[model samples]
Target: MAAIMENVTFIDSSTCAILISAFKAMQLKKTGRLVLADSPVVQSLIELTRLHTVFEILPNQKSGIIGIDGRVKFAITIIGPVN
Candidate 1:
């Protein structure tokens, strides 16, 4: 499986563990995207747990008018199946 991390995010061990298991399972299946958002909370947790590089991180954003504050808010599209 392939990891495509982006945005800003992270998760706890309980969550990361399950994801890791899923990743190992998917690796045997087909390559896919593993997007991660810019979430320091989750990122730190992953890091402390020694899983920062385990997943792919893609810190990118597509600029678009989302009626939030004119360039202040950017909507993101996560191209992956969480489950």
Candidate 2:
């Protein structure tokens, strides 16, 4: 599975922390996490939190969708032959 976060605006530090924990959990589960941060403010926050290294930060929603599609295809191929 994959996560697509678009046009997200965090109002508080707690919310950002919560998302960080969620992203870590997603990573542990081998889930693809993509963030669509077209806003400079959002990008700065992500960079400040160093989450850009943790998740794929895309400039637009289409990129995130493409990323998720690629990941899904890979996962399917990896699991398709399992009996």
Candidate 3:
């Protein structure tokens, strides 16, 4: 899979939409990881989306992250230096 907006410094609808679209496009996989590069845009977007239930947000949005699809639940991984 390809990463977009490596480091998101500012989160916006576009980014979220892109991610959602990609996630959907990616379809449901048993094992998958979506890494969100370090960027304020990305962080802001996550805060606005309120997707903690489906994703894990790391302190630093530049380090690394993992995302998963669950029928009973959701998974999200975040990485970077800023929580």
Task: For each candidate in turn, give its C-alpha RMSD to the true structure in angstroms.
Answer: 7.4, 9.0, 11.2
Q: 34-66 in candidate 2: lDDT tens per residue?
A: 334344555566567765665445433334333
Better candidate number, 1 or 2, judged by lDDT: 1
Candidate 1 Cα errors over 4 Å, as ranges = 1-11, 62-83
Ranking by lDDT: 3, 1, 2
**What TM-score do all the candidates reach, one by one?**
0.52, 0.47, 0.52
Per-residue lDDT tens digits of candidate 1, residues 42-83?
Answer: 566766776655654333434332333332332222233355
TM-score of 1: 0.52
What lDDT score belongs to each candidate, Candidate 1 first? 0.48, 0.46, 0.49
Q: Write one digit per residue (lDDT tens) for candidate 3, span 13-59.
A: 77667666655555544334465445555655666788544556554
- Winner by lDDT between candidate 3 and candidate 2: 3
Give the lDDT of residue 64 in candidate 1: 31
Model 3: residues with Cα > 4 Å off, grouped in runs = 2-11, 29-31, 60-83
What lDDT is reached at residue 55 by model 1? 57
Ranking by TM-score, best first? 1, 3, 2
